[model samples]
Target: MPEQDDAEREFDLKWADNAERKEPSARARMLAARWKENPPEPQPFRADPDPAGPRRSSWISTVIVLGSVAAIILLLGYANFRAPY
Candidate 1:
């Protein structure tokens, strides 16, 4: 029984060795060949600007305008509702 187990282990190792010796897939070989023939080219940095120029009114400007209008309307309402005391 021990000899049989030893033979089976040896057979499994042989099979593993054969599998490891197999060649890579066709796609892998092609990729390797391409890399060897012509390595990748280094790319340069690129910068692109927005097609449209700066906004007419920035967020801060819009916020300020909206706040000023709201305050003016509230002040007018308060003045009109005040009781004469």
Candidate 2:
């Protein structure tokens, strides 16, 4: 048990020393320095125009309007021809 403990302690110390000796790589230091010196610029926000805005009447709407007018005219003609109460 004592031997195992001693070995573990030595390993831990060696690992800590190695970690302390290691320096940040050049790329990592460059990125960190760049971020510190020039932070990211804020992006401008934009809204998309409404897709349904100001559209011309489609063929379907025109056909429906014409059909409604014709139906009203037919109804009026039938009512005129009927006997008066």
Candidate 3:
């Protein structure tokens, strides 16, 4: 057998990593070709975005993030006070 390089040997256990690249699906290829011929019109990220629209509440996300940060801070403070080594 031919000798393998360091990079090849590193990924020897990961068979998928050493495997051939995957080809796009038939449908994907068809769509890509179709778009290449006649592409769709590009629109802004928010074409008709409502100003202050009835959307999902952000308080839930804010509370989760803020609570996680507070917990981390409290844990760090407790650890520092109790056993700061």
| Best-fitting candidate, scored by lDDT | 3
List the candidate numbers ranked by lDDT, top first.
3, 2, 1
**Tens digit per residue, CA lDDT, model 2, 1-85:** 4456888899998888888467889999998999898987665566455555787669879999999999999999999889596
Candidate 1 per-residue lDDT, tens place, 1-85, comes to 4456888899998888888467889999999999899987765566344457776758889899999999999999899889565
Off by over 4 Å in 2: 1-48, 53-57
- Taking all chains together, each candidate's TM-score versus the true structure is 0.31, 0.35, 0.35
**Which residue pairs in candidate 1 collide?**
none
Higher-scoring candidate on lDDT, 1 or 2: 2
Pairs with backbone N, CA or C atoms under 3 Å apart (clashes), candidate 3? none
lDDT of 1 at 84: 69
lDDT of candidate model 2 versus the reference:
0.84
State how far residue 28 of model 3 sits from its true place (Å): 15
Q: How much RMSD separates candidate 2 from the native structure?
A: 16.4
